[model samples]
Target chain A: MYFTSFEQFINMNGHGFYVWLSYACFALLVVTNIWVAQQRHRRLRKQIKSRLGRSAKV
Target chain B: MSWFDNWHLPKWFYQMASPKWFYDFGARLQPWFAGLALILISWGLVWGLLYAPADYQQGNSFRIIYVHVPAAILGQSLFLFMAVAGAIGLIWKIKVAFMVARSATLVGASFTALALITGAVWGKPTWGTYWVWDARLTSTLILLFLYTGVMALNQAIPDRSVAGRATAILAIIGSINIPIIKYSVDWWNTLHQPSTFTLTSKPSMPPEMYIPLLLMVIGCYCFCAWLIMQRTRNEILDQERQSSWVARYLED
Candidate 1:
């Protein structure tokens, strides 16, 4: 709302590229971190289930 | 009952050390923190990027602070926290402490990397260069390496308990860098600017700018809390795979 128009907001007084790039990278970092954590959790659950199955036979 | 029984740290304190309790707590809290993080970060971004007034000197590029400052602060704080958790693990022999320390290292490193990258991006516009060997920047880089060292040590050791102890020691020793990173701007002349937010003084920026920055910082912290809890829960599961509780939990 500080900017009078949408074009000015996008350009950000010509600093838009740098500002937007940093935000984009930040988004990537957040997404990748969550994805990795979820993957680890799912993988661990599978591994534990498999181990439990094996142990049940003994 | 003896006074000692009542005086002992709350019953939950001991329960907190149990991997099962921690796993359940983390699982329950992760989504809540993640949700808070999402809402706060989005609010900060919208206000910071669009509504905040441009800096007189740096122009709009200063907006990067919403992400950069929070990431940098989180990175440094996470390292300090890892060291404290490591110390607790060492003193109390709490496996949960060790697991939390392990989970924090990589996430801390990622935040550090984000800080460095964003700092560089901001620098090119403000400082007219993308990189500098200034003390603050250099010290922060070293902080990243220390995080890597802790993670590498954890992976290289085959024995979990031994690895935990060694990593904890490494984290404690490497913590010496944290103070260096924090004081580098004050102790030595550097191209990197002095910290904007401090405990003793009002922020130089107006409320419009500072408020969004504060939101971003809190959001980053919540995100970090969620991420660490998730990873720590996974670590607990992996480490306790042989335990009867894990077996029963897995069965369901």
Candidate 2:
């Protein structure tokens, strides 16, 4: 609301790069943490299921 | 049921310390924490980026505090949690405690890395240098190295229980660095600023600024809770893969 336009909001009186970069890096890291965990969980589940299926066939 | 069943605390503690019980409890808790994290993070980012007034002194460059402060606080607290969990595991030989301690390393390392990155980026604009070897900064760097070392030590050990015992010792010893990092600015002539929001004192910033910051800190904690739960659950699955419960749970 402080800014009159989108450009102004992004510019932030010439500090836009630092401000935006910090936020972007943070957002990326947080998302990556969750994503990596979810991926690991999925892989573990798949491994377990496949192992169980193989044992059942034997 | 024994007489202890009459007391909820011991019963809950015992149950909660079991891998199956903790896994089920974490499964239920993770989504709620994730939901709160998303809500609070969005609210804080929006408010901090758009509505909050720019600092009169630092201008919009100061806005980085929204991320920096929260990450720094979470990073430190996560390390503390790792140490305490490590201590419990060492003392009790509880599998759940060891799992929790092991689960904390990756998340704690990531957060510590984030804190350092954000601090360096914020320092560029405010302090005119991207990095400095100030006491707080140096100590923080050491903390990050300690986390990395613990992770490396765990991975190098083939036996799970032995690795847990070794890493737990390192974690406890490394915790000594935490207080030094916290009080670095107070103890030494450093470029880093003193603490802003302390438990014993009124916040230095106004409500408008501190409110968003508060929300962000809470959101970070929630995110940590969610992520740690996910890692802990994965640890349980890995450790208990041959157990009947995991097989049954996976079947569904």
Predicted complexes: DockQ each: 0.85, 0.86
- Candidate that scores best on TM-score: 2
Using all chains and alpha carbons, the TM-scores for the candidates as numbered come to: 0.90, 0.90
Docking class of 1: high
TM-scores for chain B, listed for all candidates: 0.88, 0.88
Residues B1-252, candidate 2: write the lDDT tens digits.
Answer: 244336545577678678999999999998899999999999999999998888877789888889987887777788889889988776655788888988888888887788788778877777778886555455667788888899999999999989988999888888976676557644653344454322112347888888999999999999999998889999999999999999999888
Flag regions of model 1 displaced more than 4 Å. Answer: B1-7, B180-186, B190-203
lDDT, candidate 2, at A19: 92
Cα RMSD to the true fold for all candidates: 4.0, 4.1
Q: Tell me the deviation in Å of residue B68 in model 2.
A: 0.3
TM-score for the A chain of candidate 1: 0.83
Over B165-235, each residue of candidate 1 has an lDDT whose tens digit, in order, gives 89999888888756765586456543354543221133488999899999999999999999999999989
